[model samples]
Structure formats: C-alpha cells, structure tokens
Target: MIKIVEVESNKDLKSFIDFPHELYKSDPNYVPALYMSEKHLLTKHPFHHHSEMSLFLAYKNGKIAGRIAAILNVNYNTFHKDSVGFFGFFESTNDFNVAEKLFEVAEKWLKAKKAVKIIGPVNPSTNESCGYLVEGKNEPPVVMMPYNQPYYHDLFLKMGFHKNTDLLAYLIDVGSFQDKSVKMLDLLSQRLSKRGIIVRKVNLKYFKKEIAECMTVYNEAWDKNLGFVPMTDEEFEQMANDAKMILDPDFCLVAEYEGKAIGFTLCIPDINQIQIKMKKGRLFPFGIFKLLLGRKKIKKLRVLALGVKEEYRRVGIEAVLYGTLLKNAREKGIVEAEASWILEENQMMNRALENLNGHMYKRYRIVEKAIL
Candidate 1:
C-alpha cells in the first residue's frame, strides 16, 4: 500500500530534499543538489512573495517512493493571464501507482487554489532550474540544470501530461570548437566599436549597477519566449546575489554602446564537478575546502545566461559574447562548455550556437495537463 503525505515538518522537508540522492544512488550521472541551497529556495526565497507551494511525498511500506511540489505562481498567472499551476521538484520510483498518487495530490492542492491547469517541472518558476531530461542521460547535468531518471518522461506522459514545449542544451568543446566565427571576432568587435559599442568584462566593483542593467536586457530579450514572464526586481536581485558567489568576472561579459548596457553573457564554472564529490551536497567537514580548492580543477563551464536587448539583436553582439567566452574559457584551461535550456523555437540563437559547432546533446521537456 502507498500513502501520500504533505511535507509539514522540517524533518519531512529534509527527507524530501534528500530523497533523490537515495533514488538515484546507482545512477552515475546524478549530481545531488546542495542541501542548504535547496532549503533556502524552498523556504526563504523571494519567490514566495508572489507564489504559494506545497511539497508532497509518496511513501510505500514506510519508505519514500516519490515526491513533488504543487505551486500556484501568482506572478506567472498575472503575467500570462491564465490560471495555471506548476508542479516541480518531482522525483519518484518506477511504480506507476506511486507516481499517479503523487500527481493526484498535487492536482488536488492546485485545484483548491483555483488553478485550472497544471504545468511544469519548473522547481517553482522559470527563473530557476526547470524541465526534465528527455534526452542525453549519459552525462551529468551542468550546474543549476535538471537531471532525472529516463522514466520521468514516461511517468508524466502516462499521467496525461502532454508536451507544452522543449528546452535544448548544446555542448561546445572549449579546446577545439568549429570556430567558424573565430576569424570574425575581430571584425565584429571593430564594427561594434564603430557604433560606439564595446565588449568588456563585468565590473565586480559596480556589481549592483551592472546587474541591474543586465536584468533590463534579460527581461526585454526573453520577453517573447514561450512561457516567459518577467522576473520581479527582487527575484532577479536575489538570484544575482547567489550567482555573485561563483562568478568570475572574465566569464561574465557585457556589451555596452555609449555606456548603455545592451547585451551580456554569464558563464560560471561547473561547480557540479565539485558538488558531485561533496557527500550529499554538504559543504562541511572538509567539503568547503574541497569546494574552494577544487574550483581550480573545474574545467567545464555552463553558459547560464546570454541575452541582447531587442534593438541590439542582429548586430553581431551575440557572436562577440560567445567569442569572448570562448577565448576566456581557453585561457582558463576549461575543456568543455554547455549553452543550455534554449527554447526550441529560438532559431537565431540556436543557429548561432550550431554555427560554432555546439551540438544539441540534451533536451528537456515541460508538459501540461488540464486540472480537471
């Protein structure tokens, strides 16, 4: 027999966070999320200011069999003008009944909140990690991306979730990319310079100001993407603060024209290389030392965010950002990089990545089902 329980106590929540570790113990590619970070995102993040969520766990024979989060994102609804709820942080056993019961509880919770439809795998929002791995399960996920058992897709489909859209992740070899545009980097930079545009490493000293401008570009650039809703000021800043910890200025580049920030790209070291070694994603009892020192051993990078303001699009600024990151990654001895979670419909950016020989190695899907 299976029982579904709402996560109410801190103990239950810990188990909720830790369940995946046990679930994927034998899966070599599973990278456990940092326990503390997951806790903060669940309990204290500013996302809670505009959304409500409840975590549920499915137990069989008194052992955790699965878990899910049912979310009512007020901000998303207000922006999209739809009564859509979201489900995320989902993990489960291969048991169909367990998965069904978990979704049933999530649907019930969202129905109470008047969410007419349920959509996701977005831990809580599009601003954070979302989607389930439907392709490329052979490798571990880069930092801040989702990875799941191959059965996850089947579970959702069997539960009546249909495809909403897919997110793409491309892998680039830092040491030897096609680099068809490598020769054009200089020409692109010069042309932009003629227009009073300059590409430079972000100024950590002026982080607050720089990040604010980047957020402006971010909101405008991604405004048209499917399911995108502009992140509130507080949400962007809170996320920036966390990124600041691991940011290397060289990997965070910005393009400005006449001192107006218009385009930027953020690539961070793949700390998952370090986190994977940390037992249970804990950063204590020597894990901290490994994290700090192991960073130098990190040879992979994830192009977490890249965007150009609408007016700046098609002006070679995008190529310049990639070129800059490529050069920096090589200098740092980075061997691999991934430009990820691009919408499948984003032809221009997808083509640009493909031009540089970025192979689409991973695909993530976000699905939906009517609440009824």
Candidate 2:
C-alpha cells in the first residue's frame, strides 16, 4: 500500500529534503543540492513570511517513494490576480502509482485552500529554481537550474498536467563565437559614456549597497514578465547572501547612469561540476574544500539574470553587458556558457542571443492543471 504523509516533524522534513538524493542515486547526471541551504529554504527562508507551503512525502513499504510541496503563494496571486496554487520540490521513484498518489494529495490540499488552478514544479516560486528537464536529459544541469529523471515528464502527463510554457537554455561557445557586438563593444561603450551611462563590474567592496541598487533595477525590469511577482526586500537580500558565496565580481556587471544603477547582469560559475562530486551535498568535513579549491577550475558559467530598466531599453546596454561578460569569460579560460530559463515568448532577448551565435540546446517546461 502507498501512503502519503504530511511532513510535520523535523524527521519527516529531513526525509522530504533528502528524498531526491536517494531517488537519483544511480543516475550519473544528478547533482545534489546543499543540505543546509535546503533546510533554510524549507524552514526559515524569507519566502515563508509571505507565502504558505506544506510538504508531503509518499511512503511505500516503510521507504520514501516520493515527495512534494503544496504552496499557496499569496504574493503571486495578489500580483497576478489569479487563484492558482503551486506544487513544487517534487521527486518520485519510477512507480506510477507513487507519483499519482503524491500529486493527488498535493492537489487535494490546494483544493481545500480554494485554489482554482495548480501550476508548477516551482521549487516554491519562479524567482527560484523551477521546471522539469524535458529535453536535456543526457547532460547535468547548470548552476541554479533543475534536473530530473526522464520518467518524471511521463509521470506529470499521466497525472493530468499540461505544459504552460517552455523555458529555453542557450549554449554559447564563447571561444568560437565572433559577433559584431563584441567588435563594436568599444564604440557602444563610448556612446553610453557620452550619455553619462557606464557599465562596470559589480562593486563587491560595497556588496550590500550594490545589491540594494541592483534590486531596484531588478524588480522594475522584470515586473511585467509572466508569472513574475516582485520579490520583497527580505527575499532579495536572502538570495544575494546565498549568491555571494559563489559570486565572482568579474562575471557580474552593473550599468549606471549619472551614478544611479539602471541595469545589471549576473553570471556565476557553473559549480555543479564541483557539486556533482559532493556525496549527499554535505558541506562539512570535506565538501567546503572542494568548493573553494574547485571554483577556479570551473570552465563554464550560466548567465543567470540580466535586466535593464524600461527607459534604458534599445540603448545598447544589453549588448555591452553581454559583450563584456563574454570577453572576460574568454580571458579567464572559460570555453562555454549557458544562458538559461529564458521565456519562449521573449523574442527580443532570444534574437539577441541567437545573434551572438548561441544555440538553443535545452528546454524545460512549467506544467499546470485546472483543479477547480
């Protein structure tokens, strides 16, 4: 018999967080998330201040068979004006019965909360890692991206979920990519300079102040995106703190006009190469050394985010940021990078990436079901 149990105690929560590590143990491409980070996110992260989430685990014959989190993102509904709840942090074995039972319980919980529709695999929200690997099943995921077994897609389909949208991941061969943007970077910089807008690396020295400035640009730049909800101050700060551990100022840039931050782009080393070697994703005893020593050896990056204020659009800031980031990555001996989770409908940015010879290599989907 399959049983679904709400994760109410510390032990159950541990099981919920650790289930994926066990489920993907035999998979070569699996990269385990850090245990401590997962704990904080589920237990005490700032997201909990404004949203509600309940975790559930599926047990079969006294062993964990699957796990999921039913979330009601009040902020998301308030901003988007939709009655949609979310199911996230999902993991399961190959058994269809187990997957079905897990989703059934999660949907029941959301239905009781009066949610009319359910959408996700959003590790709680779109501002965080979400989606399922639909196309890129052969390779390991990049930093801050999601990955899962091929069977998970089939499982979602069988459970009545349908694709809401596909997020695109583009691979750029930086070493071989030759674009006019790079060639004209100097001219672009000069034009921006004449307008008193300058692009430069993020000031890690004033990290807190820099983050605060960038937050303004970030919230404004992405406010109009589908499924976007402006992150509260606490949420953005928590993310910045987590990112600082892996941040390289060289790969993060800011665009300033008259000393006011107007835009920013952030890329981080694809540290999954190091994390994949971590057994169980523990950071103590030996994992810390691997992370610290392995960073410089990482040869790939992910263009995690890039945003410019609406007024600054069409001013070549985007091209300048991408050009400078590529030049720096090449100088650092980085051969390849992935700019991912780009919305399929974002034609301008998509075209810009293609212009730089970026190949759309992987696709992920956010699935949804009408529960009402």
Candidate 3:
C-alpha cells in the first residue's frame, strides 16, 4: 500500500531533504545537495513571500518511495498573466504508481490554488534549479544544474506531461576554445571601448554597489526569457549572499558604458566537484576539511549567468565577457566549463557559444500539462 503524507514537521522535512541521498546512493554521478541549503530553500527562501508550496512524501510498505512540491508562484502568475502552477523537487522510485500518485497530489493541490495549467520540475522556480535530465547522463551535473536518472523523462511523459521548452548546457574546454575568438577578444574589446563600453572584472571593493548594478542588468537582461519572473530585491540579495562564498572575482565580469552597467557574466567554481566527496553533503566532522582542501583542486566552472541590456546587444560585449572569463580560467589552470541552461530559442547566444566551440552536452526539458 502507498500512503501520501504531507510534510508538516521538522522530522518529515528532514526526511524529505535526505531521501535523495539514500535514493541515489549507488549512483556515482549523483551529488548530494547541502542539507542546510535545501532546508532554507524549502522553508524560508524569499520566494515564499509571493508563493505557496506544499511538500509531500510517498511511502510504500513503511519506506519512503517518492517526494514532490506543488508550487503556486503568485509572482510568476502576476508577471506573465497566466495561472500556471509548478511541480518541483520531484523524486520517485521506478514504480509508475508512486510517480502517478505524487503528480496526482501535486495536481490536486495546484487545482485548489486556482492554477489553470501546470508546468515544471522547477524545484520551486526557474530562479533556482529547474528541469529534468532528458539527455547526457554520463557525468555528474555542473554547479547548480539538475541531474537524474534517464528514466525520469519517461516517468513524466507517462503521466501525460508534454514538452514546454528544452534547455541546453554547453561544455567548453578551456584549453581548446576557438583561437580566433580568443585572438579577436582584444580587438573587439578595444572597438567596444571606442563606443564608451569597457569590459572589466567585478570590483570587490564596492561589492554591494556592484551587486546592485548586477541586479539591474540581470532584471533587464532576463526579463524576456520564458517563465522568467523578476527577482525582488530581497530575493536577489538573498541569492547574492549565498553565492558570495564560492564566487571567484576573476570569473565575474561586467560590461560598462560610460560608467554605467550594461552587461555582466557570473561564473562560480564547480563546487559540485567538492560536494561529490563530502560524504552525504555534510560540512563538519571532516567534511569541512574535504571541502576547504579540495576548493583549489577544482578544475571547472559554470557560467551560471550572462546577460546584456537590450540596446547593448550585438556590440561584442557577450564575446568579451566569454573571452575574459575563458582567458582568466586558462591562466588559473581550470580546464573545463559549462555555460548552462540556455533556452533553445536563444539562437544568438547559442550561436555565440557554439562559435566558441561550446558543445551542447546535456539537454533538460521543462514539461507542462493543461490542468483545467
């Protein structure tokens, strides 16, 4: 018998967070998320200010079988003017019944919230981790990217979910990126300078000011993306605070025009490299040593974000950002990078990355179904 239980207590929440650690224990490429971080995201993240979500666990014969979170993103609905709910934090055993029950619970919850259509696997929202791994199951995911068994795609489809949009993850070898692109960087940057746009690393001395500028660029640059909802000041600040720990100033770049921020790219070390060895995602009792000792040994980074103002597009700022980051990465001995979660429809950015020899190694999809 399968029983569906809502997570209401700390004990249940802990089980909800820890289930995947046990579920994927035998899978070599599964990286366990930090328990503390998952806790905060579920219970206290700023998304809660404008959204309501419920977490549920499925148990069969007294053992946990699956988990899911049904989210009503009020902000997303208001911004897009669509009553779309989302399903995220999904995990289940191979049994079709368990998966169906989980989605049924999610659907029921969303319908009660007045959602007309359901779309996701967004782990809450696109602002955080989203998508299901439909391709590229060979290696572990890069930082802040989703990874799961190949069967997940089938599971969603079996439940009548259809493709919403496919997201692309491109891998760039730091040692072998297009030399022509590298060679033209200095020239292009110089040309951009003539237009009053200069490319430079983010200044840590004015960290807060730089972050504010980044927020501006981020909100403007990504506003047009599918399923994107502008981050409130609180949400951006909260995310920035968490990202500050692993941020490499060299990999963070900003494009300025006459002293005004126009574009930016933020990359962080692929911390999953360290987390993979952290033994169930703990940072104490020697996990701390493993983390600190392994930070410098990390060899890859994820271009977590890159964006330019609408008027600033096609002026070579994007190439400069990529070039500066790649050059700095090679100098620092990093050999692998992934520019991930790019929308498939973003042809210009996709072409730019492909021009730099970025290979589309992984593909993730957000699935949707009309609920009304």
Candidate 4:
C-alpha cells in the first residue's frame, strides 16, 4: 500500500525537494533546481510571511512515489474575499494510487484549514512560476519556469480538475522579426511625453525607494485582478534580491507624471541561456564559468512584470513601458522578448502587447478540482 508522509524534519524535507531528481532522472527535457535554493523556498523563504504551507511525500513500498504542498494564502483569500486553497510544488511517478494519496493529504490539510476551493500546480503561488504545460511540449521551459511530463496533465484531469484560466507566452525571433516595435518606440516615447508622461531608466541608487513605489502600485493596481494576491514587504524584498544578479538597469524602466511613480516594466535576461548550461541550478566550479561565458550569448528577454498604478491607467503608460524596453533591447543588440503569463481575461494588457506585434506562441493552464 502507498502511504502519505508529512515532511517534519530537514532530512524528510530534503527528500521532498530531491524526489523530483529521481522522478525525472532520465527525462532530457527536465532541469533540476538547485538543492539549497529549493530547500529554502520550501522552509525559510520570505514567502512564508503572508502564506502558510505544508509539504508531503508519498512512498509506495518504501520507494518515493510522489510529492506536493498544500498552500493556504491568507492574504490572497482576504484580498479576493473567498476561502480558496492551493496545491503547488507537485510531482509524481506514474502511479495514480500514489498520486491519489498525495492529493488526498493536501486536500485534508487544506480542508481542516477551512479552505473552500482548491486550485493550482502553482509551485507555491501565482506570484511565482504557476501552471501546468497543457500545450507546447516540444520546447523546454525558460528560466525560472516550470516543465513537466505530458502525462501529468492527464492525471490532474482524471482527478477532476478543470482549467480555471489559461496563461499565454509569446515568442519573437530577434533574427527574423522586423523591428517595428523597436523602430516605433522612439516616436511613441515622444508622443507619450507630449501627453505629460515620461519614461526613464530606474536609478539603482534609490533601489529601495523605487521598489517601494512599485509595491504600492502593485497593491493598488492589481487589487481586483483575478487570482491576485498582494506581495508583503518581505516577499517584495525577496524578489528584489533574486533579480539583482540579472537585472539590466536600462531594461528596467518606470514612467512618471509630476514626480510620482505610476507605471513600470522589468525585462530580465533569459537566464535559461545560462540555466541550460547550469545542468543543476548550482554555482559550483564549472557552473559559474558557464554562466559568465553564456551571459553575453543571451539574446532573449522576459518582460517579467509590468504594472500601471490605478490613477495612471489607460493613459498610454503601458505603450511607453513597452516602447522603452524594446528600445533598450535594440541598443543592446538583443532581438526577441517575451511578455508572458498574462491572464486570458486581462484584455487590456493583451491588446497592448498585440499592438506591438507580439504573437501568442505558448500556453500554460491553471487547473482546479474539488476534493470528493
């Protein structure tokens, strides 16, 4: 019989983090996360400030079979006014019996915590890389993204989960696509200035203050968005620290009007360029060399986050942000960029991207099921 075990000690938690290493041992498309990074993500990560989660492992006849985490986002529920729980950090062998036990444990714990509906495969939460690959199985996931076997989708569906919303990823080939976006950005920037708005590179000397401005806009602008959860000060700080290593100052821009921060965009070097060389997300001997050597070789970018504070909405701030990022990319000789995981219902952002010629290239889905 398969048995479900709660992760209680460091050793068990290590097993929970390392289980996927064995599960995907021979899968070429799979990339292993850094052992230490994942451990901290599970146990001591700053995300714990606003959310509570428990990790579990499933063993079948003494062999690891599956793993998952039950997440209770108190802040998310408070913001959305609903008691919705989440399941994330999920992975498993092909045995449905083991999978069922793992799922049941998360459901029971969440139910006891008073969660009414369960949604995800969110790794932790939507603020992080969230979703299951429902399409585009041939290409591996980009940096800081999730990848899984095609069969996992079947398992979730059989367990009664339905798609809540689909997330989109668009790809532009720098080598091929004519740079209409890049060419027009200067004109767009000038047009925006005439409208009383200006876009400028963020000043690193005031990093803390600028990030604070962003966090405030985030909380206000995204308050009513679907599956939106406000980031705590700790969470925002955690994210900032992670981005410091790869953030290009020019590529990170903010739009202002009369001196207050209103809109912003962050474009990160597709670390997948280096991540592919990373082998196992580590910084040891050869890893650092590969990263440094591959850094300049990175020609792709991910427009990681973009927001316009409420008062600045629908005033061409987004166009300015988009225009500015493209302009910086062109100057740096980088050709392609991805503005991703936009919620299907977020028509405003969608239109802004399409207006710049980005194509819908990849799709991921967030699925949910009520535990019976």
Report, for all candidates in order, the number of backbone clashes: 0, 0, 0, 0
Which candidate number has the best lDDT?
Answer: 2
The estimated TM-scores of all candidates read 0.98, 0.98, 0.98, 0.94
Off by over 4 Å in 2: none
lDDT for predicted candidate 1 compared with the true structure = 0.90
lDDT of 1 by residue, 243-340 (tens): 89999999999999999899889888999988887778888888889889998999999999999998878888888899888988888899999998
lDDT for model 2, please. Answer: 0.91
The alpha-carbon RMSD values of the candidates against the true structure, listed in the order shown, are: 1.1, 1.0, 1.0, 1.9
What lDDT, from 0 to 1, does candidate 3 have? 0.90
| Candidate 1: stretches off by over 4 Å | 178-180
The local lDDT score (0 to 100) that residue 332 gets in candidate 3 is 98
lDDT of 4 by residue, 145-262 (tens): 7888778888988788898989888775544545454667778778778877888888889989888977877778777666778888988878877887788898898888777778
Q: Which ten contiguous residues of candidate 4 have the minimum total lDDT?
A: 172-181
Worst 10 residues of 1 by lDDT: 176-185
**Residue 116 deviation, candidate 4, in Å?**
1.9
> Which ranking of candidates, highest lDDT first?
2, 1, 3, 4
